[model samples]
Target: MTQKSPVESLIQLSAFDPVSREDPHARMKPLREQCPVWRDETAKTWVVSRYADVRAIVSDNTLWRNGINAEEGSFARLLVNQEKLDLPPGERQSILTMDDPDHARIRTPLAKALYARVAKARPKIDAIVKETLDGVAGKKSFDLIEDVAIPIPIITIARILGVDDARLGEFRHWSEGAILALNPVRTPAETAHMEASNAALDAYFTELMAERRAKPQDDLVSDMVALQAAGAPLSDIELKINLLALLIGGNLTTTDLIGNGVRLLLLHPAEREKLAANAALAPQAVEEILRYEGPVDITGRVLSGERELGGCPMHKGQSVMVVLRSANRDPDIFERPDAFDITRKAVPHMSFGGGTHICIGAPLARMEGIAFFSVFFQRFPTLKLVDEAPQWRTLPFFRGLERLMVEV
Candidate 1:
């Protein structure tokens, strides 16, 4: 086997290199073609980039969700060793991190709550999208990340959980901190902020739970609390953990996904025009956007036992990084994969993932995407980027614009 290049070795360590963040597709394309299951030497883990390999690994239920210590170098060791002090790394993971029966026991009820809330929120989601846009009505230039993308999902999720609207700004701050906490290289200040955010979150949710129990509204939290009282009750810890998951998942992923879509639309005028002309294509465009440049690039999984993926030896307990973004663009799976086409016959993409751990919020995300693009085009027909080159954030796990300066 050939010796790995410096870049490949650096990737292993999960360093936040500017080149990859600015244009990872350029760097990843050649690597994925040459090595489907390549290990990052510095990061000490395997990264699978091909569509077939990534899909197979993700589909296999035997794999455990693994490898949360994202900070690079010795700082990572500090986090792992001090695991007792860590917040529960919540996603779909809060309840389903364990194997089999236990996983199902915890997840079943939570999934029910999520599905019910999504159905109830559909009619009003469109209005929420318009209301967000209205906040910046007549503005010449605005930061899409701050003014629009972040607020929409946070407020929607907050409202669904019956969280106080007055605390919207606080929710945004803590959510951003929690999301940034996913990064390994957080400085002392960032780490402090993250810890404070988690502490505040615990306290806030604790109060909300008390309030819900007292008032007993028809919101999701109230519903869950009521269910517990009648017969099946989620534990206090479980409830708090699940609330964190819903808030973060509901807000962060959709925010980045929406930002990515708007950024792509601006870059590719031809595709944007096609969507503007036919609003019905908004849903397809969202899928294409997800395939072409989804917000989340990769996620980690632990091998349950010795298995060979793409002919590479994957041992039990070894970490595997499923490169969803790279897999979506694999030339083998997608012809002319680089091109963004809304009307192309549906090609299955792993944007929401697959199998047991598939995203639970996919329905809500789709609604938000369609609503945002539909109204975005209609509201700001002549919107154009003030700075054609968007300042993309240097986040390895998350992909999004730091700021989208647009003139309406």
Candidate 2:
């Protein structure tokens, strides 16, 4: 039998394929085994699988650079709502796209504030979850995402940001547009949606900041406004973009996490029963869910210098796609990598990423996940997945569904 070259193996590999997105482990296992750092000739990108290589590459800032195309590469792509700005040539990028001191500069101002807010969000999270669940009480059937998963993150984050509930309709519409901006293979309609959303986001945040400055509510925007007022170096655009990034970044993936966790739980009945029996296991269940079906399937970086990864030489200016989802299921690191066992001990996963660019919203996401599942399972103990073959959004970069139909 003849073996294909690394590039040849990846020549036909397209991450956007529906089959591959539905079953990423099956698709990635071969590449992870034979070509952990395969190059794609047509796309001119390197693909990194395996836990060790992925962690090493993302952690090493000197070897790789972010901030190129914010939508396609870096953590920026995970949760984004962007507009093509005509700013001065040296205008700064969002913190998601930034590397080193630049990224740290923006993150430092709000990092502590973000942690504090999420830490204090428990009572709020519980209230929101109960309220959200209460809304669907009479319905025997409902879309998990629309009725359950989506609202928890959006409403919770909105409350955290002091967004008026009346504006949520507009906010949800704008957010839909923003998510499309992250699609690498968006259609003309999707492009239009993204642009429209970007404009709305800018206007909405501008107005929000103005209002916060006048009234100073007990919320995230106010916290940021306070920091800005206190001479913590922040530009108007920086403040707006950073806050928007936080909003979208926190909501997008967390929504996916909840929906995915529900799907995984339904698919594995024994595990679901175990989680239902003991609510305390919800935290570990969240970890297992993340490992099995994470929100962000892939993140990327651009090579800054000639680097060797997985014994393959890659030159500067090239791009690398790091499959965080793939690394989580490394057979070497996991006893039964493919199994969805909620009781599985936590052994770290790349769903939240690593290094300096690690997700600032990790704690909030975890807390949300634990709260969401614990309440959701308890609320609908006999909830049935109405559509076993539920539809999925065939997004290459993001893993989520259009709807998760469930019978309460």
Candidate 3:
């Protein structure tokens, strides 16, 4: 019998594979221990698995997100799509796909506006959570994903963005479709759904912007419009695209965070009791949930210059796939990493990517998690998981349940 090489072994653990998707840690454990860094010739990329290695790669600014220097047909180039170079700057990329000057230019104003909005949004967030839970009250059995996790973030973010309650159903549908952007491998139907959502968002924002200009209101959309009018360095298209990005980013991940956190609490009744006994533990529990099963599993970077990582020689234009989940679970970083302990004091998790490109909406997501968990168990003390073996979504680079059925 022939033994599979490390590269072959790594390649087989494709994110699209069901077995890998269901329990990636089982496949990642061996690689993290033995082959921390291995170049997959098939994908023409370097896969980094260990905690230290993943941290170094993400923190290094030398590796860029834009893939401007990437070689043709390489993973980096494929990510940015060099073919779109001729398009307008705003038309070509979102803040996630930009580097340095362009990234800062757009990120600055957006972050200022978003952080300001989120800082004052605590009251609104609590109200939204209460309202959502109110809807699920009196139900004997319901899907945590559909009934609770999904609605809270969508409503909270929509309110933040100045979107009206009347159009919330549409916003939810568009967000569901737009989240397909996170999936690298998409079927034809998925691609179409994403495109349609993008188009709808563009049109809606365009009209909304015009309205805000005509009569500015006291919401995020109006604040952004005022900033642009005050000479912020943002194009119309850039503003629209980033707003769409925020809409999706603000909700989808938070939804998963709530779902995953609740599931963890259900799976470990002792932990739930601990949290219920002391609401102060909610914040720590949220961090543990992020470390254990974050919504995002992987993030990538393209090398701008030749460099070596974890004893492996890498070249300019090569891509590095950072396995965030693996890094969070590395035994070297967290004691008994696989075990979920809200009280554990350890290094910060890589669920939110590090460095310049760290998630801007992380605070908002964290707030939502804390708010949801603090109230959820208290509201439904008898809540219990109806399905022990809940199904996880097959989308690569993301970790979320398709449905978390529960009874109250």
Candidate 4:
């Protein structure tokens, strides 16, 4: 057996690697320190790891999400290709995979409607969280991911989308399967499941859209229908595609936020005690958790024109993978970056990416997190982890646990 060079080892490092997946900071710290803008020849992409570099790349408007210069087989190209597969020919891509003009056209109305929905849904979100916790009240132990984390967001988003309680389970199933679309290297079975879920969602939403068109209800679907009827510049296809995006985005990532926050609090009892002592600390603790262990891992961009980043000269049409988790832990920006301190002053984290393409669902995710944590510890004062070792999911570009078992 031959020992690989340091650069080779770093090049081989991937989110899918079990060791790296479980503890990416260990692998990423070396990469950030040694080569902040390292190019992975195998993936034909530049990997930006340092906080400053990632911020610069994301903040630059010249960088494109439409994959104009993205190398073949690169993560950017994979995302673009997947979007192509999901949409019909000649249709605009979802805001997640498109540049401005089209991206803004679709995003503005959706963002407006979503913000309004989330703003008014706070009380409902709290009620949902309390009701969800109430569901597991008598149980001595339960999987936090399934019992608490999963239901709150799913139920909330379902109601927002006009999906009734009767179909919450089906809505959840589609969301779980459809989220596989984010995994660039999904298996054939996973791919099939994703497609099936997409198909089911398409059919369901199509019917619902027609119904909403005929009779507008007081929900997101109806809100969108009203927006379109009032000439909001969104087409039917874009509306459906983005609705699907909101559904998947709103559920899984928020689920992980709750799950990861609980795990973090459990692991750091002192921090938990502080939060338990002061409910006002819940919002700050949520931010700390987002910084320390965010759900999404990497967001990338394709250079629209030739540009230099992190002292590295890059060409037109080249892709740059911004490691958000790595940036969150960059020592240059974060003091004691590796330590989990819930009371740390709120520093903006790259967990929700940055700039124009920042995750639009972020406010709502934060709301869900604050709502969950505000009452969770108070309700289950005796909560503790069943397993200290977390079982992280293997899905690339996503950092979430497969399960978080706990005793209350």
- Please report the candidate that would top TM-score against the real structure: 3
Query: Which lDDT tens digits does candidate 2 get at residues 131-156?
Result: 98899989989998888888788777
Local accuracy of candidate 4 as per-residue lDDT tens digits, 153-255: 8788888889867877898888878888777778999999999999999898998899999988888999999988999987777788888888777678998
lDDT of each: 0.75, 0.78, 0.83, 0.83
Question: How would you encode candidate 1's per-residue C-alpha lDDT over 280-387 as one tens digit per residue?
Answer: 988898899889888777766677688886667767666777778888888888889999888877868888777677777888888888888876876777888888
The C-alpha stretches of model 3 lying farther than 4 A from their native spots are: 1-15, 81-83, 184-190
Instruction: Point out where model 2 deviates above 4 Å.
Output: 1-15, 67-92, 185-189
Of the two candidates 2 and 4, the one with more favorable TM-score, higher being better, is 4
- On residues 314-366, what C-alpha lDDT tens digit does candidate 3 reach at each position? 88778788889889999998989989888876549999988888898998998
- Stretches of candidate 1 off by over 4 Å are 1-7, 10-15, 67-81, 85-101
Candidate 3 lDDT (Cα, 0 to 1): 0.83
In angstroms, how far off is 146's CA in candidate 4? 1.5
Report backbone clashes per prediction. 7, 0, 0, 1
Ranking by TM-score: 3, 4, 2, 1
Candidate 1 clashes: the total is 7
